[model samples]
Target: MARAQREIGAALLEVTRHADVPSEALRDDGLIEAIPELAALGETPQDPHWHPEGDVLVHSLWAADLAASHALEHDLDADRRQLLVTASLFHDVGKPQTTRRMNGRISSHGHAERGGEVFRAMGRRLALPRPLVDAVAAIVETHMAHLSVRGDPSPRAVRRLQHRLAAAGTSLDDWGIVVRCDGEARGPAARPDASQPWRRVAARLQ
Candidate 1:
């Protein structure tokens, strides 16, 4: 494993294991400075209607924490677990750039694809393995595909997403995990209603 990968994996695992709290390792290692997108999240505001929790940074870590718990429940292997954790961390990297107030609501339109592009560059800069980087970026880019399914519910759409996942060396299972975690991070007020249907479709494809 790349050193950058191991360091991030360990830091995220610690955060995920400890109820999403910022671990000492992360602070001491200067991960925030190393990953500026994370620092930017602190300044980005989220609409309370959706994110009753707080800023994008808070939501990202919270989601990663949830993902870690789910990974344990499912007994995911280290690689899959790491991928989920990493994707969760990078999931909203574009929010700082894409977030905007529209109709009295904060929206991050196209943030997923924007985030994916940011991660691809960041991953390369950090010297992360090419396949791992691409896979994580793929998951981030397509994370919102499930929401479309909630509205459309088309098998063709599902198949198209599946092909994309395969091309990136990931699977529907991995994509679904990130989506569910991201949706649930809003806390109970904004429950993952849409995610449930998406999960059903993803489950069939998996």
Candidate 2:
């Protein structure tokens, strides 16, 4: 991780610890039961840059909601829906661990990597299914790939992603939906372009 991100992550962790905020408190099951206002925590409200809908915290909630709604429409099996919802909710949990303010442009920079680590720790603590844990990790790792490639991912880029998923024994379809959920929830009119190159890449796998 970058130096600035590392420092910020430490500081955020310090804040969480100092506040005696349990990670479990933010977890789906725990939050649903313990903190009725859990959904309202850590959110950044509307801004001109990046999040037009609000902060990363709000965007994460939107992603989780999108995943839930889409899973219901597809009539996903209970296990699949569980995986999708859990992954969506927890994918960016590491952002709180590593908040960076560069030139007043707040960015988590390397939070994807740190966030994946956070998810892994959370999964182990919760005793999540091994495959589900693995799937979530992959999704977290590649969460920004679509954005990084903009709208024109090369065939080579697609192939590389496919190869990595295959090696991890994960499904592009599962992760693709997670990515779509994220894109659709990021801001006002936040729907992802249906014709995005990466969506085509996912279709080829289907």
Best by TM-score: 1
Question: What's the distance in Å from true for residue 151, model 2?
Answer: 3.4
Q: Per-residue CA lDDT of candidate 1, range 94-152, in tens?
A: 88999999889999999999999998887766667688888989999988776563364
lDDT of each: 0.76, 0.61
Can you give the lDDT of residue 156 in candidate 1? 72
- What's the distance in Å from true for residue 22, model 1? 7.0
TM-scores of all predicted structures: 0.83, 0.72
Global CA lDDT of candidate 2, please? 0.61
Top of the candidates by lDDT = 1
Give the Cα-based TM-score of candidate 1 against the true structure: 0.83
Q: What is residue 94's positional error in candidate 1, in angstroms?
A: 1.1
Report the lDDT tens digits of candidate 2 across residue range 1-206: 23343343333233222222223324522343232122333553333465676666667767776777777788776667766766666666667656666676777777677777877775565455567677778778777777666666877777777777666556666778877777787666576543257758656655
* Model 1 per-residue lDDT at 123: 73
